[model samples]
Target: MNPETAKPATAAEHFFDRELSWLEFNDRVLQEALDARTPLVERLKFVAIFSSNLDEFFMVRISGLIERERAGAAGSAPAGMAPSQQLDAIRTHLARQTALQHRLFDGELRELMKQHGILLLDYAALDEPQRGALEAHFSGQVFPVLTPLSVDAGHPFPQMSNLSLNLAVIVEDPVNGLRKFARIKVPDTLPRFVALPQGPDQAGWTGVPLEQLIAGNLARLFPGMIVRGHHMFRITRDADFTVREDEAEDLMLAIEEEVGKRHLDGFVCRLEIERSMPAELRESLMEELEVSSRDVYEFDGLLNLRDLFYFLSLPLPELKDMPWTPVVPAPFQAAPDESGEPRATLFDAIKRGDVLVHHPYHSFAATVQEFITQAAHDPQVLAIKLTLYRTSGDSPIVRALIAAAAARKQVVALIELKARFDEENNIAWANRLEDAGAHVVYGVVGLKTHTKIALVVRKEEEALRRYVHVGTGNYNPKTANLYTDLGLLSCRDDLVADVGDLFNYLTGYSRQDAYRKLLVAPLTLRRRMYELITREMEHARSGAGGHIVAKMNALVDPEMIRHLYEASRAGVRIELVVRGICCLRPGVPGLSENIRVISVVGRYLEHSRIFRFKNGGADEYYIGSADWMTRNLDHRVEAVTPVEDAAAVHHLEQVLAFLLNDNRHAWDLQSDGRYLQRQPAEGEPERAAQALLMEGARLGEF
Candidate 1:
């Protein structure tokens, strides 16, 4: 059915809520754990990922919402919800999701343990011998780091740091006929799980949670004082930092100082003792944390489920999924006798002509990093230009850039300071780049240079020819191992010209000019997409094979969504593979019935952004760093270059076909914002996009 074949609607629903849409994406990720075909331990990891994702959502997005509410801002939620109304809805849904999270975590953990002959013991469940061993472990390892606080006429409430788990203790001095409140923060340095020494009554390889261990050791810390009761709690403070641009002489220095000070701030979210706790103790916690009931969560397990990641790394291979290694592209990693050693050299290959690499299938290390490394050290290479957004700790790209700069070769690196949570690392890289005599720019004020592009200019035979590498993912090789991204290596003059222009626009004098072959953000990407959509509308009206295929990390731009809706109305065949955060409602009558959307979640992250627009019979292909989010298309700097290489275009199209046809890791979008997996038909084959690619990679190696 064509996306444009929707029945007409008399009334229309507003755009989907961005926050709720994000939550749904997370839900899809969580559903992976329920998939019986996915390895049990790997399913456990999905649960880990879901919890971690939620923790970040609260720390950043929810924190922002709380701040807005406190400021009495009049902004409505992205889906037409009033600020207050959005908050209420968000909290209610979050509570439900968290409840689901609790069940999945507990169930998966129990299953893994049962299969592996390991056990987790609660305070009440611990046997005498285990209890004795735990007490000893607590005394030796945990008690020294503990700090007990008492609330009395002489002492006020104790302070807690953001996300710090503390025990709210209610003690009594029976002799003095007095009641007291005390607090002890579970030390951050201590591991959240303590393995107990097995004794005669051992429930094979049993362990206790760190919080419970501390609860048991409460008497040891406050000896001779009647240890009444203690309840576990945690606080999440406002993480937003404020730095005045005008006041700072050096922006990096200012950010560094401000980042240091952010540790101390007002409470943003809190988690308190889940079960029955004294009202007085709860009230005291509220007063100390300085937050209301909405900020608090009562949980059954631990205050920070995020810490479960530590235990999730069980190292029990049998309990885990089949481990598979990333493969280098056959063209690059093929045997010297088979594919020629020269084919492996990315720089030489690109200098000779151009090459396109699809990552995870093709090794990012051998492609993106190797290209940079060769450019930096090559005697033929005279200058290098690159963009740095996010990379690993021991990044080969950074080392190569530094080596080039130290060797007196021209190296210019644009480090985006506002990369969110990676600000400090980027600043560190910026300083290193600057110290090595490489020209480092913080990009335009308020605009993040999110484009992943690099240009290497070498004096080839007295005239300079440009070697360029552009991608849909960051230069970070670590993520490249998991994220499905596409990159191109070319000395193509037209592509070179556009990339050179883009680099100059970021680092040197800003050139307000039209890009020749690249669709750049904050200028023409959105306009070009709008025009393409219009062209598709024209083609559909002309009775041609009008179609649109787009793969992106998110689909949340209101205008872009509306345009897709219009294209649906115009009789265009639209298929979207949005890996996360899709807001456009598909399969609705008269709205987007022509539009079909699916999300693929698997071992490898679906990350590359590729779009195909059918201009009657002829199709145009584009791959880029930008998603369809408003920030990418309107606020941040991004680039999408057309894939003109016939082989490359075929490659991208095949990938799009795979994702669209996928069933095992794919979930179809319904009109009501729910993603339902397409049930496999009897005698019909299973299709997992990633698995098929991995098979292709294996065959390519042969």
Candidate 2:
């Protein structure tokens, strides 16, 4: 057999389906809920997380596939699955996972909650006094907000908003001997779980499903009609959209219009109905909603388990994991002098050397937020430039920017209004910044600015020095407490200059294509990454022991995966810690024998992106905002900075080591595209990476 005449492997032979891989990640989330070792309330939280994740997946990924299938798009996914095929596979996989989810919630979690004195009751379970109390409460509160739309000849079928829970009611008119169908949307403003008044013997918290309460009181909603029955249902719509920046005159207005359309005009992608819903009513719903049978899901238990989040708010500390408070890094803590006075500000600490902060372990407010706040108030600061992709509702960072503008400091904010599901929030922040006299630009055309960067220029003596903050997550302090992220505060000359140039490119008419120490996407990032991988391949061929370790939220670029596979064939050892949506098929016999992939899903979302390459023993480390996805590397404006500071690089190395050594909360990806959770063997001490990090942060070891 001639080697040159042999055929090459297709992409389908080398990669896993992207959508299925994402579902597997969510399955890991459901696994957390099934794991009895986890605290009871924490397991409930995981169930809610899983539900929310599936909602978004349908709204975006599944919706896109539906559209492609309708249009008969010819392009297939990298895994060689067409849109229709992927849809079929997704439905099959999702049905099994959702069945498991229902079993865990109904058969296990609910029973366990009862044992712990927590009650999630139905309307039928409420006692006489409790029912009387709820009737009065409903009449006063829920009745006024309820609007039941009757589906008759006069009124066409009412449009259901995205993810709204509703009751399909059948009421008979006794006087006319006629029946009518109506829809009642369960108010989102009201709590999904209505608390029940405790009896003398009841010891713990008790609540009833809001929908059940509505179902029990349908006669109140229809005074003169004979109420038949009501069944619960939910619908998910296509919430994904694209703004044509070239055609739009105003980017912000365009984004706002798209967001408005998202709520009212998205096509229904999924329909969820209870098993009790009659076949006739179900078919009517399918017809009116214009959803096919393939998209319909029947559940034996609750419709939307995302409402399980309500349980987390109960003051049952015994059934929850111990709360963690992010600590201020040692450098950021103002050390006292002999006179008991503070030494210096956050800027002063950065001047000495680079300061590295890891969130959910290190405090975001003490580090990144403080950096912006002090820059806003500092008189010597000449200008502040930052990129706003996503932030909190009551963002202190935005307030500081407004304060800087009020103080007559030069402020330039590159607000990205096209951030998915965050367009409205970003627009509100952009308008506030513009009204405050800060120059707010909607990033460069044809690209969503996904970079996390901030530059502060200050005047010291006769010279102007620049300070920069580069991170892997958004600037939202709220999410900073729930996500594992990394940020670097530096005043180094070359890195700061690069960040300043990147800001110029974002806010002005600069076609800057290169950076000295930073990797800017869509220009140098992809090329540089390929070069790095190729260099490792060369090193491996030369017997120099090539090695690479990368941590990110996803790894979906086919070219990048191919490069990694080539390096693996060259004897380079590659390890990937991707938190979600990894398409690479690792640990194959010949294709990727030297590569391994693992995903970590736990208490905190692993949101940081770190890349390490052992360049013939002279290692190179980077921490930045770009993943290996094509959208990140080729379509979005992203930034990745080298951790040149020895201390910062060492910290990143330690983080990678912790992630790789983790036995708990980590799942190894097999060549067959299955994820097996890693568990400690007998006599092996438990090593949970996140717990270890928390301990280290408390001891100030990081």
Candidate 3:
């Protein structure tokens, strides 16, 4: 057992290892799989999510350890432990979790399948009738796609691609009668779950793994040979891409080409051949993958059950979550003109003053999409400038940009192609944007342009007015319908001026020195936030009302953490709604007792960053793209804008207060790292924050 996993008998390390912290988060996700309250289908989705998360960890984190070991840079993690120490810790934790996963998943899946009347057949479980049917289907469909390669003097081992599941088969020739190793790649083009032919189970619901069917038909695949043994396994390789800027003549093209090759990365992790398999076959697989025993995990039943995600769409309504769609906010639902229209035209609302939107609760399609789509074709709109980090693979936002460019409107785009996993999508979008005559710029060299800002230049009779849309999340409509984020559409002079300068910085050669209404990072975000919090502390010391309320994804930056502690000591009541990794030790004697930290993990991913400070008699409110983490505050180019509209500010506080009061889906953080799940105090129903708000948004229509 990992030291981190064990409950300390005494006062031990106050902090958990960062890697262990991540694993704890993963465990929380796995907990959702076993959560009886969750919809049955959603629970299965969580299992798939857990598998996907672990796969990425092996590709990035585990792969990094291997790279460090190869380069003799083993003492990499800052905790002072050697690189080997970290790797050993990782292996121990993974082994424990893997065992737990099998225990939880196999049992739950079996019970769920029984309840749903859907069975997944295994090779031996199938009768002669089923075998005959599978054979006919295999010959017609699966055989054409099958490619078998034998390991002899003729074949040097082929390069194994990342995330490919394959079989290690042992076959003996009838004539020569010498056993040889053969490899059969699982055809990804074919569906992982194969439906049976001419059965009630097939017509309604029931399936078998393609691997099981292939295993049963192994003799047919290898004619004039006897299949002694075969085992199913998978290899997860290092998919992290590294490209040298100096080598690329065109950075965009080079990045796209490199991204295409990322699938064929170095093998780093392996899910093992079954323990029931022959020792020689297992040994052969380990040799081929170049993995140690620690790197290989063995499961009792299935190899890649993550494919169960496909079964989630099995047309079992009772087994799935109640269908829910995003709600349009009350303000927008009310007729804008008091006459008739689909709410208000977004531009007119911004022209009226500022409009703030909270997504999933507020319809993203109505608010943000309308903002851009309106501007794209509006005759009064002169130019549009937007910063895109990551959008969905297919986005209406990109279509709006193209339309804006087609209208001969000057469209400037700052496309950040280095957005980790979304690099390829961004690269493709950039090329399309460039070809459309839109002024497209790859973001800053050192810092990622993470600021979600949109500038619209429009003619308003007397002069050209700049209306800016600043947000705490991406412009991706899909995420907007799932993530709790804030978007402010405003035409304030100071904010519009700052946005104009930002556009100049991104699209032109101008260097912006200072922003009047916004605090931007990689330049001025930290100092500005520090000054705001310090002012609140000063007011609290002077016997003025002082309070600090912030909502963010994580709170891990040391400098900011110390500042928060100082504020807590100065009699400033701080409420933090952090959804993930928090290193700050709250509720400590003489340290941070006034500081209250709670995390809300529910259906929607809490992604927005909001900061509210009570400055003497006046209140200061801000919404931005940056979190309190170091990477967001100091390293990335981010934006924080003031919520100047009185109505908008009122609305922001309305929701923030509700989230703070939330007990259900909220976990209170202790002085140590443990997150104590908040249960209902009395026999009252749970106050699930997201669900309550969603109901509010739904009922707000009244």
Candidate 4:
């Protein structure tokens, strides 16, 4: 284990390929759709999630690998995988997973939907009446949007936008008997699934794929030509682009320009065509798109299952998961005062004790939103400062900040304009905030401000007091109902001071490198994490019994993985609940036998980052906006705070314990990089961590 003796090739054995690990995570998402126990409509949601996830994977990860390959980049991955090698691995893995997804939808889900009186009928399967209705609808609604671009000597090839689904059509001119090729982009503005009128036999809804409707009515567009054949196709472009923040005069303008260019300028990373597509057409597509065979994926059933999300709007409550509303935490819930009025505000509640709110389980509207809304209107509040990584389009948090700014309260918003795919939205938000008189900063020059922390300075009695809310997710209310996240509200002196200092470092040129209580990334997080792991190792070596449990979205940093391995070798029991992209190999005899890794993929996305160290029986817990990824630790600005409140610490401990014991949704990772979904033993009760958490939330457990 000597660092001097270690070779890069040997070190590769201890980790899995980052790209392949991600594909495996997507495969786990596919597994959710494949699981029969999941509700019918919920399964469709998972299929959509899987498709959406793969789209991003191609746009960002696959595109990056292709770029590296084109530049002839050497093996720079910690797993010692060359760019070309990773690309090949992704192609092979993704093809298999995508095929499985298609089969599940086409073979099983469609049939299941039919039984539930919901029909996803093809054009050929439609009855005369249904066809007549669709024809009328298509002529009136869809024909106006259709623009068929021809590929001829005079026309040249059309530029396909990223993730645009289209129909590759072949037509013959009867006069000359010449075959012509044209592409009709399916309008994204229209619904992908065209709903059919309810029939006598079908109690629920019936819908046809929009592409099928377009394909069936091709002759309407080509009046004189004979429609030979038509096949569906989709293209995924390289959406990953970097804005040179250091060189640009205005970071927002640079990002806006980059965002505009990304759609039209990026190279084709993947081409998805229907399996029935002719060889000549496929070859022509490959040639015109400048994509190799490795980049092409042929699908049998559907081009984009992401459109399955459309069916979720159907009013079939029995076919979906039981909806649960998030409850307001007891601390935030209003109580009757002596005069029969509502009791103290959120500020007063936080001042009483640290309040931890878990999203989706804890009402975001009643907690985080209420906090900001109150701050905006609070007469005593002096200033509001926060960082925006990603938020919803109609974000209440942004509006509150704008309100605070309008009220003449000093408002500083560090909006990250480079949050990948969200650049345009973030840019729009930045502009809106700026126009509303809020001071908007585009974050650090070379680093992204990813910390999800907010500071509100208010005059309490006489002195000014700083209250902070640090979280593991964005302040997006829409996602708050979807993603499981944690946020801590406190007026703790040391924590508030650290957050103030962090904001100063972000908004102004404060060369701050240290903090009292919080772990700020790129300066203290990496070093402190290593020290924590080493301390656990020391504890285990001294026979004090060491244990560490951490949960995050991903675990990708090599040094962090190595530290975990070292801790495992030192006899520290390391349990990691990484939801995606785990590079570290666990349970190796000598290297990491003491390490156990599990991933939980279920109803809600596991997004919160929780780190717990036994600390020789004196448990130390932390929750923050960081994963073990290098980007999170050394590249982005992050903050991790100690959960000093005994109640919050206990709640986190319970969460970790539930995840570890979860049988229904947990997937255990083996040393050989394979994951096996856990199941309850005979006579054992079914245990799903998310479901349990929801029940606990309803019962006011935390």
Candidate 5:
């Protein structure tokens, strides 16, 4: 009955469908919306996130499958499903998720929010005065930006932008008595919901859907034609194009051209239309978009519920979750003397020992950003090297890099131009860094340099010591407040040497095969991971209580899953806290009986990756940016540094324990790929991981 003794099953039987697992993850997000315990506005936020996440899923994942299916390359995925099979499953699951999204929004959250005085009035429900006011607002603000394109013999079907909401009108030529189709793209510059001015009887601010307002006054746009019927529809196009870096003369230009092309010419992946659209009109739209019934979603309410984010951020504090401000870790905070200004800086603290930062709980500004800023101004700091995958528009990290370069310090910034949707932003940063006298590398030839690491070389009294900041998330200060990530500010000699070599391999042609204190992907990480798992199995077989715990965004790598299964069979207790996609079929009798997987979705995104191994009481832990996915382990540059510092190891252990013990926001993955929501046992108190972390942050305990 042991996992080691159980016969090995086929790949298909052992793994869950990847696309379906992703849909299940999104469903978990939707479950947050269905929960009445969640705050009203926060529930709305989850709905918006669900919609946004699904849109991206289709754009990249579904579109890739469609392309493969078209090219006759419908190969089986790691989970043993062909592209066609996965597509069919995705269509069914996504349809259900979409339907549930609308039901939660229109049937529940909308009414609940209205009762809280945030009125979302439909055009049909508006009074004459309110209608007139909205019409005036539309005429002045929205009318000038509107451009209506006619589709007839004289005019071709207009090129539609990806994810743009538009009104498809069936206009009748009054003189000729012929019906035609025309499109009016809702201005992306305008808000999806416009707030109307408060009237004498209006209790709270009433808002009108922007599309509804435009639909009500359609006659004004097409002055001579009779407006027969109009319905809202949105197009989601394939935005997951890769720049042929090998064939490209300039990677930046290639990425930019691809980005622009996706706006106009990307293949349509989804066509979401209003359910009230006539059957004939819907058919015509599907034909024009070149998408069949499989890709069409007829929503009963809003087409793009992602616009609900606007209302989620409204100043309705009573209906929202309490605001959380990230606290400064005790190590990062300065210790003021009697004069109140005689404290040591972040650099001084790092010089003493390693400082571990748990973000959204610990302030990134006080640690990561401060580290870069101080390095830029310090005269002794000679050079800086960092890898930038994705960051904010007004990124303080980018600004600091520019300052460091301007100060005549040797600065190398490897900007990954293919960070999925952030190509343009990275391009802008690369240009800014180049203009500011920094050497910019557009990543490696084929792989994305995704390691979140920054190395600073300082000419100290002892020697030219290296200071490193390696993290599990982007260096962007904005996301640091929203994503739960871990970072270590260390000056450890071995760790520093590994980080320097990593930067060298990223920037130059020098490639080292192994690292001392860090496990790097595509070279040492995978082999080291196997060794770690094998060591755990050996320990368990030798009568030592073997324990393995890991937390990542996903766990889809087949080799790693197989290792975990083998370890499970060997009596090792394997615990995984994956936030998103997980293909491992845990809790399968005799196969994965020793393994347990849990997912935590809460206020802060669980973005950090942690790996722990109880190596016969010689405990080892690592934290970094690599997830247990093939792309991260074999196709991208990643770094995972050992937590040699006892305090940092304790912090990671606490985090893993909190995530595994969570009841309110955790979902357990089953052998059949279905997730069961974890609930508190009778008489057991409820515990939310994010809340516990927040409380710990307030107390400066984590």
Candidate 6:
């Protein structure tokens, strides 16, 4: 093991800490909460979103790192930091964020809400009548559902569920004079915030925390015990579990069992307790939970701020952002005839040429949903195939498949059961689809099927034709309104044939090494992407135009980052619009000076992945679900389809340009691993990509 014989440092040395970078992205969300320009209710919703995001981060990312640290695993991540060091840094940063969160909720937000008559009152702050009413409400609505467990020689501490807020009460046995710890889990069935009756002539809402009411009435639960202290706490558990797809006898059962374990048996990753909790009590709970001091957080405000969604959902219009209805792309809407009757169908629109649909701005219901609904009812349609990773709870897409199957049309569905936290929902949908007589596949072994595609085969005239929809997002209409994604509807021979082949590869054992028009992951997507990058590099070297633009949710693959670095050195002007977890360092003096990266975090999530390559002025564009992450590139079964139609290509370019030029709600990544907000310069007009898209959709401009 000579020092000289050590392996050379690779491009990974230039990568940023991915976990830290993700935390930075969450901080940007926090900035949205802190921004006064955001509607007050939306600001609160952002805070809740930030909390929920952090909880998941801890469950998956931090928990994995902690396990590695405990196992004495050696070596640094791509960011070049050891697991223990990353944990330390995470704790420091999270402490700052927690402090800021409490400051916002307890300070400015509280005063503002008070002025609007939305009082977050504590049990002690309630008047006698209000307190009495709450006591009555607790007795009727909460007490029966509560379970109190004692921690002692006779009774070991109860297993705490993940992320459930609980009250740790110290009660003294009156006769024996013995002190004991009791735990009461706040029922998830009950609302986190309980509404109270408005005062005479009152106009706004007032509420009390269910925990505060329960804590105040502990004496009623244990009539003979003397309550001494009560403190609130929550625990986050490890949720990263993978099915052994190769060994699994049933993928569905494995996923179902794993999802169950997520709630009942995950290793504790972090413990959050009230800051005022006694040191001894805190240590006791920590010891019982088997968590380290570094994993503990002391919060002064309400724990589990994700519960703030309760307040965010209030019917206070003035406190929320104005609603804008998603519009159908103008091309999809039929023009009125002389009789004032619309005649065009979604199929007719796609038949004209490839149609590009931008979601949240363009209506998903009118395009994707209509595509499936029409196919289901159309007498000419013979079969329907779709890959569903995650969809809305009440999915119209799934219903359409069920109807098509019931109608004796061949319906094949590849439902991914291991869609992270959406496993249970996906499993339910898969079961229902199976029950409805549809042929359902649980994706491929060892790899998650993440490609968003739907193929409809129809008997048109004298021939069977295929209509394909390839998208950069899931078929979930609910998310379509919250996540910015791109979808292409096309019926071209080659593209539809490729989509048909893709469905075959996903459903049956038809393995094609090369697709006609798709870049299928774990087979051709990664190789094709590398080849494209190399082509751009060659163009740059030959003094031809070498320009590249890619927009994605994340970019963390070591090889891709290195290739981009090489292309930059070869004089390629690379612009990356990454919404989260960008590891590549941009603007380095001589290393990555030609690469520029910007992230836009606005009202809608930028979830689409678009790649553009200017190969000697022959422009090429692609849109799909795969990001540049290693999982997306090398592990998952993904699909990226080329945008061949001139009009569709132009639409993609317009989107990329709008996002790149966005000064509002956009942050630029610096070489120093920091994100600086991109604001309009003096005398420059402000531009927010999402807002502009909304306006464009209103005017039917796209």
Cα error, residue 280 of model 6, in Å, equals 1.0
* lDDT-best of 1 and 4: 4
Candidate 1 Cα outliers beyond 4 Å, as residue runs: 1-12, 74-78, 128-136, 152-156, 197-206, 242-247, 334-344
Instruction: Report the poorest 10 consecutive residues by lDDT, candidate 2.
Output: 1-10
- Residue-level lDDT of model 6, residues 561-603, one tens digit each, is 8888877777889999999999998986556788999999989
- Backbone clashes under 3 angstroms, per model: 7, 0, 1, 0, 0, 0
Better of 3 and 6 by lDDT: 6
TM-score of each: 0.92, 0.98, 0.92, 0.98, 0.98, 0.97
The C-alpha stretches of model 6 lying farther than 4 A from their native spots are 1-12, 336-341
lDDT of each: 0.80, 0.91, 0.79, 0.91, 0.89, 0.90
User: Which 10 consecutive positions of candidate 1 have the poorest summed lDDT?
Assistant: 3-12
Off by over 4 Å in 3: 1-15, 74-80, 197-204, 270-273, 334-344
Query: Tens-digit lDDT track for model 5 on 139-180?
Result: 899999999999988999899999999999999989999998
> Which portions of model 4 miss their true places by more than 4 Å?
1-10, 199-202, 338-340
lDDT of 3 by residue, 48-167 (tens): 777888888788877877777767884532234455677788888878877777777777766777577777777688888777887888899998899888898899776767788888
Positional deviation of residue 232's Cα in model 1 after best superposition, in angstroms: 1.4
Better of 3 and 4 by TM-score: 4
Mind giving the per-residue lDDT tens digits that candidate 2 earns over 486-540?
9999999999999988988888899899799999998899999999998998898
What is the C-alpha local distance difference test score of candidate 3?
0.79
In candidate 4, position 550 carries an lDDT of 95
